[model samples]
Target: MNGPTRRGDLFDDVDGARRFTGPTTGDERRMLIDVLRAQRSTLRLKCSGLGPELSLRSAEPSALSLLGLVRHLADVERRWFRQVLAGQDAPPLFSSTTDPDGDFDGATDDPQVVAAAWEAWRTEVAFAEQFVTGAPGLDIEGEDSWRGTVSLRWVLIHMIEEYARHNGHADLLRERIDGAIGL
Candidate 1:
């Protein structure tokens, strides 16, 4: 892997991250899947090589943190893929009815908390990948309370949007934490 930026610089070398390996040419489904994976990889790269600082609420007044983003993305993966797409009953791993923000609110500088966040995120991500792979096609539809009938294609697109939006926030938070920037 390549090294980070030089001192006092905000722009890190893009090649250093190598988080975007998506093919420059592919069909719609393949392209979407690859872009989404690259977004996921970008999130991971933004949070890499951090210690307890991952839990630092650099955004202030909001419970946003690198660890929180990890946990929240895990919940998102579970909701859209397992519950909505696969018709499973998997509930939020880090949030609840009375604690909808538990994923972010509970983010702390504990080793176990950090470990659990990453584990849950990875598990949900793996399940989502499998579900998408085994899916007959993106046309497969599911009912969501918020969006009514939603297709796997729509879910994949929404997930890409979600990650892209959060990755932007992550960029700011990360820069605040360690002056690291660029993705």
Candidate 2:
């Protein structure tokens, strides 16, 4: 991987943190999915080009750094998609039944931790995307036990919203780490 940038200059490389500039077709569902994927890519970009120490650094007492956000999102995908969407009773990806924040807590500078996080998140994403593709259609009126009878459309919208919210958190955390912004 590329070496990290200097302090207060984390986003020095424009080519590295490029946002989603792909063509637009004006479909709401597709657009929303694309936006979420772009945000996901942006999160990855923020972590990239950084040294392990800097990537794992915790500027505040709370574990709300970019690394933590990555881990959290990975777990969220597994929980919402693999468990909820697929109607599986399995436990969360990283979080235990008793410890809800296990994913964030387990985040570390260890390569194994990072690799596992990526794999879990990517796999969940793939599963979620596949589910979306195979979906007969969005039924915003449908409800479920977990989501309180939400429609498929609602779930997709909620996922996008969740990602956007976390991406905002990621933006701040990334900025704090190296002063990169508005990628």
Candidate 3:
């Protein structure tokens, strides 16, 4: 693998790049958010600069692509943060109960699709951050009808795990698209 991949001209230096960084020192909440942020950044870095067509193309035999991952993550963020945690009735960002895999199935080569995926992902991330920031503590509970009550800490850890797992798929998908690899 190449030494930390870089997006040419888009970032000035390693510091400016969207690379993962663990928390140096902080409380559990701060550390959790830091880890989650790093994972999110890793996903963005993995998807950067591959044009729209390549972004949508699945690695043969598997119906998975970076574009699909982006849309899927957006849906996940909206589901967990906005709907379950914030108790908002936000509709699914890219999928529905009828067509549950719409996020991946509907991923297309159009640049608009890629742009929309990123927009929705960023929007959900912002809303999640805002909600977490305003919450009293990590121990605060949220009602998930299917999963019963869950705490903010559980959600944060789950989000981190979600990103980490998808990022692994992204690593393979990205490598298949272009030879780029590494954190």
Candidate 4:
């Protein structure tokens, strides 16, 4: 397949990292989904090159790693989309009541672990997408014990915020792992 093009300082479509050219005319749902997809793509780009070993390497003294972030995002996706939104009985993919931080703490330099994280993340994302696609509208409500009734719009916004925040951490982690940095 053809590779990415470098135009000036920007690398167009490099490593599957699509630039986020905000939607100007779409409806609210479309715009929100587009923005969320862009953020997800940014995270993928940030974690692209490093293998499992490097993926598990903490940028600082803490247990924050690229693989851990992937796993954590997967859990977040499942919680909000499948559990909270769709009302599915989805349990945590990596974390649990006994080991709540397992997603991050269990991250390791194993290829299997890295692969599983990606798999889980992709699976949850697909489920989320399907849930959103089938929803009647953004106003549809979901039950959450902690937050009580929540609209799909609220969930989408929260997810976007969540991804944006973690993507910032991914940027720092990627920079520390290597000198690579970009949009």
Candidate 5:
């Protein structure tokens, strides 16, 4: 309640700070990227003013915490963009087959854990952004073992969906943590 949420948190004016313009009209690629960027910024906004509370779980049966969401999304980003799309051997930073829920289950209320989650999320996001920027076109195809064949467009839409869904959960978790709420 006294100082900025953390050392470098700039959620005071998330839109102004992050430059997340939710542009409604543009080419398909630009629009998709902008929307995804907006969704990503929304996640940051939802978690902006908290430190340890990022690890607060919602209910007894659910391991759904804001920190968990961050970690899980980090894994998701790595899986989709790095492994599936870019054909990199990037294993998830948090989860493994033996413990698929490690992202959520390991979301301890420790500063180090929170920092790692944010770092991994940001790194994966950066890679995804760069991949999108460098791609020849949205029609570029990638072979996904599960989905068979996926295009950049499909991946972008899926990432947007993933973030949007998790951001909704983030909204609730943030409100539960401190009664602060907003889109």
Candidate 6:
């Protein structure tokens, strides 16, 4: 409890809370996107100030590390925005024949890899944000093979959930790496 608990950490500030003001015709598009953005920001905040060692250190069997989280998120963002939504045929950002979770597992004690993970994560996040902002009209009736008929709003919300879940894992990993804690 040195700083803010990462569990309930979501929004950075309430200044633009009005983004979700009024009804969205029952669509929580802006709200959901804002929520996702907040979670991503929280992830960045948690990873801030750490050097290559702590950032990439995996304290357990799982590839759950700060650097890994960054890489995974970048891959996720790129997949959703560039591939699925934009209908591109791009390959995965991380994971290859040599190593599965390369983004996470491949983060050596090297400064280059750590820096690349952070940069890729930021770039992908920006791209994803722009894509969502320019998203087509909300369509809850639409269908996906995996999610099935969910709105872009729902997709955004789920992405928030995904990031939040992994961020929760990251919180614990980071805490173990060092005594540092907070949103």
RMSD values for the candidates in order, in angstroms, are 3.7, 5.3, 4.0, 4.9, 5.6, 5.3
Question: How do these models rank on TM-score, best leading?
Answer: 1, 5, 4, 3, 2, 6
**Runs of candidate 6 exceeding 4 Å displacement:** 1-27, 56-58, 140-150
lDDT of 2 by residue, 138-165 (tens): 7534435566766667777777788778
Q: Compose the digit string of candidate 6's lDDT tens values, residues 1-183.
A: 487555444434443344334444544676676678678777776676678644556555666678888888888787666766666775667876577678777766688888888788888888877877787655523444476456666667678889889878877776676655555
Q: Write the per-residue lDDT of candidate 4 for residues 47-110, one digit (tens) a residue.
A: 8767865455554578888888999999999999999888899999899999998999988988
Give lDDT per model, in order: 0.89, 0.69, 0.83, 0.84, 0.88, 0.70
User: Which ranges of candidate 1 are over 4 A from the true structure?
Assistant: 1-17
Estimate the overall C-alpha local distance difference test score of candidate 3: 0.83
Q: Give the worst 10-residue stretch by lDDT in candidate 6.
A: 15-24
* TM-score of model 1 vs. true structure: 0.91
Count of clashing residue pairs in every prediction: 0, 3, 0, 0, 0, 2
Predicted candidate 6, C-alpha RMSD? 5.3
Error of 1 at 115 (Å): 0.2
Per lDDT, what order, best first? Answer: 1, 5, 4, 3, 6, 2
Worst 10 residues of 4 by lDDT: 6-15
Tell me the spans in candidate 5 whose CA falls farther than 4 Å from its real position: 1-20
Lowest lDDT sum, 10 consecutive residues, model 2, at: 51-60
lDDT of 1 by residue, 1-183 (tens): 998855544546464466567677867788888889989988887887897999999655999999999999999999999999899999999999999999999999999999999999999999999999999999999989999999999999999999999999888888888888775
Clashes of 4: 0
Select the stronger candidate by TM-score from 1 and 4.
1
lDDT of 3 by residue, 9-97 (tens): 23224642535456678689888888898889888888777777545555566668899999999999998999998999998978898
Clashing pairs in 6: 142-149, 143-149
Q: Where is model 3 poorest over a 10-residue stretch in terms of lDDT? A: 7-16
Cα deviation at 6, candidate 3, in Å, is 15
Instruction: Name the runs in model 2 displaced over 4 angstroms.
Output: 1-18, 22-25, 54-58, 140-146
